[model samples]
Target: MRPKDEGACSGDGMAGRIITVAQQKGGSGKTTLTANLAIALRRKGFTVAVLDTDPQGSLGRWFMERLQGVGEDGGLEFSTSSAWGASYEGEKLKRRFDVVLIDTPPKIESDLRPALRVADLVLVPVASSQVDLWATEGVLDLAAREKRPVMIVLNRTRPNTRLGAEVAAGAAALGVDVARAQLAHRVSYAESLGRGGAVAEGPAGPGRDEITALADEIMAQAGIEGAATIR
Candidate 1:
C-alpha cells in the first residue's frame, strides 16, 4: 500500500484509451471485474487506473482496503467520481495511464450516458443465465446511442454449462462482440477480493488465467500493443 497521493493525479499530458464497464442489472460482478481487470493490466506492465463512478463505491472501498496493505495492488492508480462526473474524471485519468477503466452505476439512465460518451469501448458483463443475457440489451442500446463500441463479457460463468456458449452465440448472432475470455465463477475471486487482492495477484489458479486472457484481448481490441509503449 502507498499513500493516497500515489494514485493517479492530473496533467499526465497524454491521452490513453478509456474503457467503461457497465451493466443495466446488478449482481453482474461489475466491481469485481473492474478491480481484477486493473490488476491483470498492471501485470502486463501497463499504467492502469480506475475511474469508479458507481454510487455503491465498492471499487473505492476495495482500493482503500488495498491501501492498508491487505492485498497486492501493485500500486495501481484509482479514483472515484459522483454519478455524473465520470466523463470529466475519465478524461483527466487517461492522461496519466495506459488505460482508464470506468465502472459505471448499475443502471441505463443519465449517470451511465456520460461515461459511455467518453468510452472507447464499453464492456458489459453478463452472468450465466437467460435473465443475465437479457440484461445486456438495454445497455447495448445505450452504448449504441452514444456511438461507443461495446463488448459483452461473460462473467461468473459455470464452465460445464451451455449458458455461456449460448449467450456468446446469441450476442454474435446479433453482431455484438463477445469476449473470448470467460471469467468463470470461482471461490478464489470472492476470497481474493475479500482479502483486498485480485485473483491475478493471488496464487496461480483458473481465475488468474482467465483475467490474463481478458487483459490481452481487451488491449488488442483497443489496438494497444502493450502498456509499456503507451507514452
Candidate 2:
C-alpha cells in the first residue's frame, strides 16, 4: 500500500512530511535545491533530515562538508540509501525528523518509484520552457499512480520574464500546484555548495529569501500553519 500524505507542521497530526525531489533530466539543481530547502526548514526551528537516494552522492558529500564547518551548521540529520531501500529508510526518517527530504536520482527507476510511493508531496523543479515542463511528466505520472500531491517549482527563473509565468500557468492548467515563490538564477545558489554549505549558510541574499518563502508556502499547503513543529 502507498503511504498517505503527512502534515506540514506539528499540528497537522502526523509525524512529518516526506518530500521527494525528482526531475528526470539531470542538472535540475535537485541536490542544491534539496540541501538549501532542508537548511531553510531547519532555520524555522524544525527538525529536518535528508534521505540521499541519488547515486551521484552529491547530497551525501554536501552533508559531510557541512560537518567539516564549510557552511552554517544546520544540525540537520541525514542518511544515505539504496534505490531499493528508500521506502524503509523514509519511514524511519519520518519517525525521527519533522520533515524528510528525499533527493532522488535523475531518472525514473525502481529506486525512484518507492520514494514516490512514500512521499506526502513530490516537488518537481522545472525551468522556463516546455522542455522543462515536459521533463516532469514521468514524475507526475508516478505521483499520480501513487495518488500523491505535487508542487512545481520554477528554478533559475529570469526576473520580469513572461516565460516563467506562462510556464506556471500551463502547469496549473494541467492540475499541478505551482509554487508561488521561485528560485532566481543566482551565483549564490551554486557557489554556496562549493563552500560545502547551503545558500542559507551564505550571506543574506535573494537565494536565502526564496528558499525560506518556498518553505513557508509548502508548509501552508501541508496545513501546518500556527505554532506547529515536527519532533
Candidate 3:
C-alpha cells in the first residue's frame, strides 16, 4: 500500500469506502461532479482525497489550480491513480484518506475494473438526454456484475423537464439508487471550472446551493451524520 499521505485526505480515516464517479459516456459531468463533491465533503470537515483515474487529466489540472496560493488546510487533495497502478498508490492511500473520490474514464477498461472493484459506492452522472440515459446501461451492467452500490445523479438538467422522471424510472427499473436532487443547468458550474476552483469557493450564486444540496443528498445516502465524521 502507499501508506497514506499521497493525495487528499478524506476525513473519518479511510473506512474502506471508495466512492467512484464514473459513467461509460463522456460529457456526463463525471469529473466535474467528482471534483465538487470532494470539495463539498471536505467543507463538511471530512478529510477527502480525489483519485484522478481518467487519462484526460482534467481533474489533475483542476487540482493544480485549487492548490495554488492555498495554505496547508486545503479542503481537498488530488492524485492520479491509473488502472494498472491502482494496487500501488490507490491501495496505499486508502489506508489514510477518510473518503476516496475516484474519477474513472469513459468505458469499461482494465483501469476502470480495479477502481470499481475497490469502490464503496459508485456515483454516475447522467445528463438529461435519451442517449446519455441509454449509455448509462453499460456502466450499470458493470456495476451489477461487481455488486457495488451505484447511485445516479442527474447533471446539467433542464428545468421542468421529463428527463428527471424518466431517469428516476429507469434507475428504479434497473435497481440502481438515484439521487433525489438533480443539478440544474447552470453557467456557474462552468464558470467555476473556468476559475479553477469549486463553486462554493467562487462567487455566491445558485450553483453553490445546488452543489450543497447534492452533497447533502450524497451524505444522507452514505449515512454520514455530520461534518465531524469527516474531520
Tell me the whole-model lDDT of each prediction, alpha carbons only. 0.80, 0.78, 0.73
lDDT agreement of model 2 with the native = 0.78
Model 1 misplaced stretches (Cα beyond 4 Å): 1-13, 70-75, 227-231
Model 3 — TM-score against the truth? 0.85
Query: Least lDDT summed over 10 consecutive residues: which range in candidate 3?
Result: 1-10
lDDT of 1 by residue, 127-193 (tens): 8887877878889888889989988898998777677678667767656888999999888988878
lDDT of 3 by residue, 167-193 (tens): 656766766788877788887777776
After superposition on all CA atoms, what RMSD does each candidate show versus the true structure? 4.3, 5.1, 4.0
Given candidate 3, what's the lDDT at residue 84? 61
Count steric clashes of candidate 3.
Answer: 11
Best by lDDT: 1
Pairs of colliding residues, candidate 1 = none
* Residue pair clashes in candidate 2: 10-229
Provide TM-scores for the models: 0.89, 0.86, 0.85
Instruction: For candidate 2, report its TM-score.
Output: 0.86
Clashes of each: 0, 1, 11
Tell me which of candidates 2 and 3 scores higher on TM-score: 2
